[model samples]
Target: MKHILNTLIIGSLIAATASSCTAKFEDINSEPYRPGDLSADDYALGSAMNNLAGCVVSSDVNTAQFTDCLMGGPLGGYFADSNANWKATISFFNATDDWTRVFLKSDKVLPVLFSNLSVVEVVSQNTSNPVPLAIAQIIKVAAMHRVADTYGPIPYSKIGADGSITTPYDSEEMVYNKFFEELNSAIAVLNEHPNDRLTATADYIYQGDIQKWIRFANSLKLRLAMRIVNAAPDKAREMAEAAVDPQFGGVIEQNADNAAWTYFSGSVNNPLFVAKEYNHEGSKTGGDTHVAADIIAYMNGYDDPRREKYFVKSEWTGIDYVGMRRSAKVPELKTIGRKYSGINLSPNSPLYWMNAAEVSFLRAEAEAVYGFNMGGEAKTFYENGIRLSFEQWQADGVDEYLAKETKKSISYVDPNEGINSYDKELTNITVKWDESATPEQKQERIIIQKWIANWLLGNEAWADYRRTGYPHLLPATEEGNKSGGVVDSNRGARRMPYPVAEYNDNAENIEYAVNTYLGGRDDMSRDLWWAKKK
Candidate 1:
């Protein structure tokens, strides 16, 4: 009895100490720390930046690609629950921000940025400190863009809570417009602050290089402009043209200077690589999130050299796990002579992005929308975009493996052939020679090629799909699934909504905001104001 009592007392004391420590320690809190507390010019901003970047494809962009990523499979992999590859777990169907759920209290970077801005403004009142402030607001804009872009309509200019109760969702149009204004504003600020004292350590991106930030700002402007292509074409052209301004700097001209985030350098690991390839034989999160049949068919049909790099046959055993992307019954490797085309799942694989190919493609689309069938020029841009995409993924040997262009060109194909054929429930879209296609059809072919160019980066692809409606996708044959739901293998949901937790907790404000803008913000298929009407 005495010994037991002693053990109980010791346990209680230990528990009390741990409790006290947790209470005082900062990590336990759901709220972010006040930015004012930081006294250094060098502040940590990588965590917030990573989340903003990760939320795009690694989060839900793959499943929600709606059009681009599913080039191989038949029943677009988006609908099938049997998408037993590593990606399905990373992306799943209806959840874009689930991985971000646990870190929900508040994004840590916002307050830090606001605090930095406060200091910058106070320090340089009379002088125009446009450059540093521009960079700062950029961080703000990037973070907010992810939030707003992911969840259709969201709180923007009205973000701060003057100790107020809740925030409301802003109109999608208003939000997009504000994004334009903010980028311009940031540019002005960058122009104002030419001080050399500014350091790059704070920005994980470009390391505080104002010039690069300017280029990124312009690039961001181009991206946002494209978002509004359907609603306002002239406006889109105007903004895109403005980005090409030599004065503002512009998107990466070369791959060397491209804005990118690397994971291996720090404790941070590439989320995609970790979940799919490098970690636990792709089984940790779950293996081989079967590449959609549509995606498989498209690549195979083109004799796309990229096919090998992007996917591996189950018969090939570099990585263990379930079938390939097609949900195919992977045959015996030795018997079939099928080999696993290894994915560059290196922990060292580039986790961060801002690829040059994106800029080139953005330019191509910009030209296309602006009536630039301007001969081979537009096609060259399109081709360059494809080349860059292939090169990046190490799939450029397409000339060797894929069919060369013939007098009569083929376009799209049915991926239901031989080893390409997966399970019964799936269907794929492959590129075949369509000699009957006219020059315009050839243009559609060009767009389709660009479509495949967008692989891991699906948000941009989704945006492009919204703009052009290319590659022909059928709606997921589901009843309850209004958009990209469990049955939504064909079409992606229009937008992710605010978390149910946010809606329920702040019911009144959320309600007012939804009713004010689009009827029910929860409806994924209901388009954002700036998005095309189709």
Candidate 2:
């Protein structure tokens, strides 16, 4: 009994000693330093900028490659599948999910951009420095607008309101109007600090140049304003005027001022260049990317100097620029892959969100459509746009190319049998600014050239084509539209379907949006408010 009692006393003493040591060292479990204490500019601004750039320019499958390269590239008629691979993407069949990925928060870029912007906005709440906050807001609008354009109604104003996980959506129209308001607020903030440094070190597009940000903002405004011309002409004219109004700021007027983000050197090369032609076996075999017949024929017909830069000479057809038709499902695609022209594969190339050439074309369209004071006639702006595009790409013979009016787009002739051939003479459309052409003809001329200048910026090009129905994109008849009767594959996809997660997580809001904004259904057949046919 004495021995047992002694053991109990020893155990008790050890327990007490252990408790003391644990209490003494407990503080070590906490963080050495809190990251939350950092200022928005110190962290949030940089995070927002990088995240935004990544979402728009990254080569990851879920981001830029899927949304821009795979979908936008082919749909915009800038490229075609040389190997006839990725049929689901090329044919618009089984493509709904890829389209919806642009808006979904499931590891996609849009949600990351929004989250970073929110952080920036919160951090700037107590500061007199509005530059960081303004830049965040501007990028918010720039990035979200693409999302809004992808699917008709999206979570915009109510994204994180009321601390709710399931956010309600704003109508496409409401989202567009909100974009204008956001731009106005951001511009005002920027104007207040004319000399203040932007987050240049963090910014990939402008390197914190406040003036360039202002220019990009105005250029973005102009682009958005033009999008609403058909659906909301009065509002379009008003907003467009506001964009170019001297009081706000000037638009991007030179190639140097274009909103572009270059790839990081070495390991972080351009994703498109890597994914399309250099990443894996597909890339090693030259991948499926080739110049679209639609675009190549037009360029070849006009003797466009950009052709050499845009594509490699065909090895099979023995032609300098052989292209494949978009959405062509032929056995020949499997055999004659090397015969087609290859796309530009520079790993260091910059991804353009908007360019001076595109902005000039927007101004031309504005002057032609609304008679806005663009400081030049529509014809002058039109010609300037062409020259800027040539200079932007470092192409020669701008004068000679512009001088020819009679050279029409040649019909695409497939060298392989069993492949469908189109000989529509795309060049029947001329480059010469015909002063006496009908208003419709003039609009076509402007939009087609604008499309040419647009080149690789697939989302913008696709959006513009949806809005104007210009350049007369050929209809794709291959199946895979899951919308049943909702999407007319012939009219082309109007918008991507709302993500399935919305139906699961935010069912009530999704239902209401479909009923009110989407005519009782969520399908690609339904046009966004701005893209509706007039």
lDDT values of the candidates? 0.47, 0.69
- Following a full C-alpha superposition, what root-mean-square deviation does model 1 have from the true structure? 10.7
| RMSD each, Å | 10.7, 10.7
lDDT of 2 by residue, 96-166 (tens): 46455554554545445555555455445534566888887887788778777777788778775112326
Mind sharing the TM-score for model 2? 0.86
Candidate number of the best TM-score = 2
Give the TM-score of each candidate: 0.68, 0.86
Model 2 clash number: 5
